[model samples]
Target: MGTLKAWMDYLNSINGKEHDSFFKPYKEGKWSKAAIISHMMFWDRFFYEERLPHMLKGETLVGITAEQVEEMNKKAEEYAHSGITLQEIIDEALKYRQMLLDKLQDEDLSRTFTIKDRKISLQEYVNGEIEHDEHHLKQLKAK
Candidate 1:
């Protein structure tokens, strides 16, 4: 198992009780712990499943519109409240992450992709994913 695999396993260990604490709001009507997980899973799928393969094949990156981003966020929020189990979200995320890791070779790490009108390497993107996960995990722990 690689570092990514380890992280995925750690995420998979989270239970509903952990999710309840993780998703608890600082205030009412904000994103719950489940919503946060859904948001993360949404992006994991977007990047690994949708964007990464295109990027690896030298296809033009699809730019996200503000409306699309909003819609994704809204859908994520709904999914969070849909009574989906925390383990389900974790499993999906891990599967996607593993898919990404499998596709990424050492040389591919230096490959670049355009995001938000800026060019960033695959290594940068993977690092960003790890950082994003860590940040959310912190938020979950803080609740």
Candidate 2:
């Protein structure tokens, strides 16, 4: 479940669903599928474009505050509602994820990187993304 191939297969399984199914919130105060897609899309690009390259170069990542996280969530919600189709977001997210997998294809998962001086392996980071996606999947599937 930690491998890139596993993650891609999981994504492909769900990515072909109807767009309208992803447009509306499942319940009050919960995120719509569109917002979830937007959130994943944002993080996929962030990982591929910012974090992974820096990790490969052994550069430090400045700590992101709780407020910054809140802001990103707000931005994702706005993006989801700004008339962009859910399919577009899904496509871009998957593309970035593929880029990430490609970039890390021959890299050592056990190799460590520092984020705010705290060290972690690439496997740990990828697992975090899987956990995040699974959490949202559960929310979306809940009755």
- Which number leads on lDDT? 2
The C-alpha lDDT values of all candidates are 0.71, 0.77
* Residue range 1-143, candidate 1, lDDT tens digits: 12455456656567434445544563476677767777877887788778888777655686889999899988987887787777777777677777767777544677887866788787787787778778767665553
Give the distance in Å from residue 13's predicted Cα in candidate 2 to where it truly belongs: 3.2
- In candidate 1, position 59 carries an lDDT of 57
Per-residue lDDT for 90 in model 1? 70
Candidate 2 lDDT over 44-140, as tens digits, reads: 7888887888777766778888998899888988998899876777777688778887888898878778897899888888888878877766675
Q: Which runs in model 1 stand beyond 4 Å of their true positions?
A: 1-9, 15-29, 105-107
